[model samples]
Structures are given as C-alpha cells and as structure tokens.
Target: MVAGDGQGKNIDDLPDEIILNVFSFFSFNELIDTAQNVCVRWKRLAHDPVLWRDKEYIIRGRAQNGRSCCGVTCSECAHCRCEKTDREVLRTAGSMPQLRTLTMMRGTRARILRKICRNCPNLTTLQLHGCQKMNYSLLKYIFEKCPKIEKLIIANNLLADRRYAELVSRLEHLQSLEVFENRRGAGPVLLRFLADACPKLREINLSWDYHPLEDVEYFVKAKRDTLTSATVRWTMAGKRCVVTVLKEAASSLEKLQLHLFDVAPEEEAATFADLGELHNLRELHCNQLCPHRPRLISLAFQPGRLPLLQRLHLPHATGLPDDAVATICRGCPALRELRLIFATSLTDGALAEIHRLKHLQILDLSGCSGLGGCAMAHVAQLPALRTLLLQYIDDLTELQPSLRHVLDLEQLRCLNILNSGHIRAVPFEEFAVRLVNLRELHVTYEEEDEVFYKNVFAEMQSQMPRLRIINTFRWTEDDFLTDYETDDDGDDGDDDIGY
Candidate 1:
C-alpha cells in the first residue's frame, strides 16, 4: 500500500502509448537513467524498442558562441572548439538500441565502440571520418553487426589497416561507399571480391587517397555497371596512373579531384586528355601545381575546357603575402564557390580578383594569411561575395585594425571566422556585435582549441540577435592524430593549421 510498493498508482495512471511517447522525447542517456529508476512503471516503459527508433545521430559541428550583450548578440567566443563535449554526447547516444543513423568522426575513442556497434543492430547509415583510432577488427565488427548498412563512409587517415579487406568483403549489401586514402594491398583480394560481390553499389569515392600506382590499377580493374560515380585522388608524381582510371572507370565517372600538392607530374598528356574526356563528369577539382611547374597550371587552364564543371575547388592554403590570390583568381571565372585555404600566397589583391567574377556565391578564406582588414576592406566593396570562410589562419593577429575593415561586408550573409586565432581579440568581439545583417556566422575551434570561443560568443550574443543557424567543427591534424587526452598541450600550439 506504500507509494513505492508494487501496487502503486504509477502503472494504473498512464496507458502504454503515452508512456512510450514520453520516453521517446528524451535522449538516449536520459532514457537510460530514467529506465533504471525505482519506479516500476517507468522501468516497464523503457523496454519498448519503438521509443528509440526515432533517435538520429549527427556529428556536432562548431556552433556560434551564445553570448548576448544588453539585447545584442556578440560574434566571438572563447570555447569554439566543442570537441570534448561533442564526443561525450556521441558516446552516450550509442546506448540507444534502435539507432538508425550514426556519425562518429574526429578521433572517436574505441573504448565502448564495440558496445555501440553491437547494440545498434538496425543501423542503416554510418559515417566514420578522421577517427584515427578506428582499427581493422573494430571495423569488421561494425560491418558484421550492422548488416543493414546501406551507406558507409570511412575516410581520412594516412595509416592503412587491414580492415579494408574485411569491410569491402562485407559491403555486399552496401549501395554506396565513401573512402579517403585507405591502404588495402595485401588484405586478401577484397577489391576483386567487391567488384563481383557488391553488384548493387552505385558510388565509390577514392578521392583524397594517397595511393600507389599498383593499388590504383587494382581499383580501376573493378568494373561494375552499377558504378555511376568514382572519385580519384592523385598527385602529379602518380600522374601515369590516370590512364588506368580513365581507361577502366572514366566512362561512368561523375566526380574527380586531381589535386597537385608537394608533388610533380609523372604523366602529362594522357592525364589531361583523360580529364577532358570524362564527358559524363559534372564536377572536377584541379589544383595549381605546388612545385615550380607552371606548365601543369597551363594544362588545367587550356583554352575552353571542363564545360560540365558545376563546382570548382582551388587551393589557396594560407598567407597572401603581397596578394598572390589576385593572380590565382584569374584562372576560374566559372566557379560558383571558392575555398582559399591558408596557402600564404594571397593578399587583398587575391580578394580583389574574386570580386571580378560575378558567379562566386560561397568563399572560404579560412587560413589565407595576411588577409586581414586591408584585404577585406577592399572586398567589402564587392557586390557578389555572399559567404566567407575564415578558420585557423594564425597570421590574422591584427584583427582590430581589420575589424573596422571586415564589418564593411554588410552584404555578406554567412561569415565564418571560426578559428582565426591570430586575429586580435578586441575587434573580433566587436564585429560579432555589429554584424547584425549577418544571417549565419561561425567562430570555430576544435577540442583543444577551446580557449576563446565562449568569451567571443558571449560578447557576440549581446550584439547580433537575429542569427538563425550556426555550425562549427575541429578540422586540424591534432583532432585526428595525437590523442586528445594524451597530449592536450602537445600542438606547441600550431597544427592542421596545415598550410
């Protein structure tokens, strides 16, 4: 007869559907803790698998620091790198048995991951990227446990594990595969097996892989009519292998990234010809060669080429000393979006050139060095530049001076100055307050770089209050390599800041 007794009013009060509905609203962790409570009715409601079926998992990107100042929101934050917090949430989210989608990236720990993969039997999609700890056995376990996996994404690691063979073998049920630099040479004949076994596979991504010539040839041999999209990543040094790619797979290829960095061309004419011949290709990303190879750049910009090119990516990774960008921007007039990474070869002159193209909708100046107030002071005058990306450029140390210049971009809708650490803190916070016209803004830093995000965002909330959406991320070498917990202070303070 006691309130805590078996015959208490708890069970008699609510119907099955209502209790399950209530449980469904809570996240995986909240539901778990509540299920373990002494209340019998609450515990009974937790057993319904239907309660967890709606749970979706997504990688949390960097978000705007939420700090308001006297009815105005500030733009800067001290804790932009939300790595530790996001990882903890991901770990807890794995408790849900009926999880349909799972996105675990940026060096996720493998500690409780086996439990995560094993419990989520009904999982339909999995996105694994920058997860340096991902091992062969763990991946095999994941594939076997999640039999219904229709989409699989494993990307961005230099060290290749034997798991590729295991994963490729099990992907017989998989419809799409996204891979980045996976090393699978001696891991059985999995490629051969995948070519035959996975008949339904329509898309395969090999772009960004630092693969060898022989391994590339192996990929080309995998002929399947179901293959509609194939992405390849090769430096000019391995240019000879482009023939294998074109002869074997170009007929059905839709996307390709022929990036040239710290390397030179081994095969010139055939590679360029193959690139031009992919008649069905809709997207092509060709970078200006890094070495003293002006001819390679000549090859990419030959006459009237790449007609179907919808999206183009150019490498402007950091430091626009005297404004090298002004020269680089002349090559691509058809580009709708541009990413000028911290290549240190650009300046106000580069931003000036982008202004000439009427087509640029999106622009990422994340790490282009020397690109502070002086350059943007010029770009603010442009009419077409809508989106701007500025993450992890250490040279932006003089931001206050640039702050007055940057705010001039009133027409800009999305301004992403996410982890421009070198930018002075004073004007950085000031811009977040004044940029009210800014619909979207990002001041990002990842896990260890969580120094000034909160402070900047706090100041920002008080200045700008109309922001509808903000996303953030940690995209440096340290996030994926060098254990976050093992060496919190290891970066000597500069990394994937990888210019």
Candidate 2:
C-alpha cells in the first residue's frame, strides 16, 4: 500500500522491512528527513543501522578520533532545512553499532568522536585532512579509546603533548602512520616508542629537525637499524637542508633525502657504513656541502661502492671535481635523475661525462651560477632528458644566449627558473610564442616598470596557452632608478682625475 506522497497509496500501512525498502528509495540526504515523518514502524525501519553505512569522513582527525561522525541532526533548522531531525548524528550512528571506516572534514563538537570509538570498537581505516580545531585531547581520548586502528594519516596539527609516544605505543596493532613533524622535543621518544611497541613497523618518516652536525652522526649510529624510509629536514644559515636517514631497521626502505649539509671537511672521509648496510638503497639526496677539502664524492664513491644506488641529488654542490662526476657516471652506469643545484664551481667540461647514465631523465641545474651558455648547450644534448630546472643561472646574463641553447628541451614538460632575473635580455615574446607545448613554467625577472609586467601578462596569455600553472615572478629592488650626475659638469673638459 503506497501512501499519498504522490505514489498514491498507504506505504506506512506495509510491513516494517518493506517500509524500509520503500524508504531506501530516497537518497541518504532525503532519508534523514523522510525518516522523521513516517509512522513509528516506518521510522524505525528508515533509521535502521545498515542505512548509515560508511559515512564519508572528511576529517583530518586521528585514525582513532573516537568521535561519532555526525552533523547537528537539526531538522527544519536554518543551518539544515529539514522537518525536525534529531539534533545529533551520534544517535543515528550509535543505533548502527557496526561503523568501521570514518573520514572527517571538521570537528566543533566535544568527545563526540570518543563516543563513536567507545561504541564502534571494530573501526579500522581513518583519514583526517582539515580538522584544525580538533584538539589533542580528542586525539589522546581516541588513542586510549580505539585500540585496534590500522591505517592512520594525520596532517597539519600542532597537538604537542607529553605522552604522545606513550599513547602511540599503546596502539599495539598500528601500521602505516604518517605523522607531521613534532613542533616540540617529543618526537624522539615517539620514535623510541614506535620502535619498541610497533615491532613490525615497515615505513617510518621522522623529522630529523635541527640536529647539530655533530649529533646527526650520533642519531644515525643509534637508529641505523630501525629507520626504513626517513627524511631529516632542517635549516642551516637560512638555507633549506633535507637529510634522509635509511638503512637496516627499515630493511625495505626505498627513498632517502639529506639536504644541504657542510659535510665536506678536509679529513679522512667520513663513514657511511650504515648506508652501505641497507643493500636496498635506491635514492640518496644531499644538498650543498662545504668545500673540496673534505670531498663528499671521495667519501662515498671509492672505486665501486654504493652499487645499489641509482638516483642522486648533489644539488648546489661545491668542491666536487669534474673527475668525480666522471667517475660516478662511469661507475654507476644505471644512474638517473642527477641534480646539480647551485654548482658554483662546476663547468660545462664536467658534464662531458654525462654519457654514463643509461636511463637519465631529470637534470636540475638550478642556481648553477657559473654554468653559462656553453654548459647549458651541452646539457641540451642529453637524448633522454625530460624535466630541466635552470633557475638563476646569472652566468647566462644574455637572454637568447641560453634560450636558443635549450632548443632540445622538446621532451621537457616541466621547467622552473623563477627569479632568473636575467630574462631582460631574452625576447619574452618569442619564448611565449615558441614553447606552446610547455606545460609548467616558473620563470621570473626583475623590473620597476609596470608596463613590462602588462606586456608579460599579455605575452603569457598569447604564448603558452596550454600552461597549467604559471609560478608568479617579481622584480624586487630592480624597480628603482640610479642617477649619476654632478653639480660641476662644466669643468669636465680638462680636469685632473680627482677633480
């Protein structure tokens, strides 16, 4: 008997399960409202637990936020125009009792999550991306509440507490955790707790933040066995440095990053004995080391070591001789993705040995100050090259000088050279014209005139019409003028040098 909502019969007059089957005709949003209007039996069937299955959790909460996924359940309220629904979604989800997966967006409620955790003990997968207001008290409550959580992802929260490690240690069944770096000094204990409790841990990303150069070795020596895929990022002298520590503990470790460290001291080369132990070492990244005296190249590439190593980043490198680059090219024939950033002393002659990489694609020469036109021209010769970053090569002071040299960037898809201020010499119109196939551009120059910018916009709109994202550029102090005139200019004809 279908009732008079238009179907023209009495559906409330049907059996409980049949009425639920009828209510299921409406969408989840509609079900929330229709559930309230029907008779007690129809309402109970519409409010059945199975109807509230896997509510898409848009939250950045802990995997175990222990919160019930709910909105204010307001019916006919201004916030949600419905016909008087329960003021809490917890009542609906609580009735279900078997809620497993939860993804959340924002949380302005109390331990509503804790109530959900206490009710649904079988919860597994959880992803929280934007719950900025949700405090750690809720997170701490979830950890204590939800003990069986498996996959947990938390991003962008500053919830620092004393017992973060203790709580994580208690989650004996935890696997796959990607935590943001801790703002305080609590992470070390967190690492220790993870190591002690989560014995089967395979993937770990810990922030080796600001460990003085002296302590890096100490920490490495201590945790060499446990860190599988670890990146230690820090700042030294105001430059970005990302140091990756990986080895035995993370036996399945794959990627590693060690950015800008002044490691090239003139001594008996340092030992990467722990790195050699990994046997699965694939990618290694190291940024700007000090100088040639304690050569980093000599330390690692002695004859035929780091054999499993393939991808390398010696960005902004100094003191490394052309012969070392040549040796590595010759030794690591499988090498690819060589990044020579800010290579102040590297010359085009050094790159003559690039024939070594059997499968090279990405060559990042960003900030390579002394690498002028000829060197760039040589780089253009790589047959398999795909992505090239040539930002800030002040040596290419002339525009077309290096622009024409990059003609072979045909295989290129991504190009980043922002603030490469020397673009004034290059005809920006011509580049906007030729590189139509280019996808990503981050080129910038210096100028004080607003008209130059207007031209740039008009040119970009016409030139690279296919561009996805144009990294904005600016000309800082270059927008100013310098005048050089004297009050006694009339005496210039025959005056002494000083006069």
Tens digit of lDDT per residue, candidate 1, span 1-499?
2346666665446687876776666654466555636477666677466764544454332342222122222222211112234455555544456666675434444544556677778887777655335545556677788888877776534224334654555666787777654343412223444555565676666555545555556555665334666655554124445534655665666666665444334555445455555555556665543544333443443334444444656565332233334433454455667665655665555566556556667777666665556666665555566787777766555544545666666567887766556444436455664555677766545556456656666567666666644545534443233322211221223221100
Candidate 2 least-lDDT 10 residues: 77-86
Q: For every model shown, what is its TM-score relative to the native structure?
A: 0.58, 0.57
lDDT of each: 0.54, 0.53
Best by TM-score: 1
RMSD value for candidate 2: 17.0
lDDT of 2 by residue, 290-338 (tens): 5445344654554456566768888766666666677666656566688
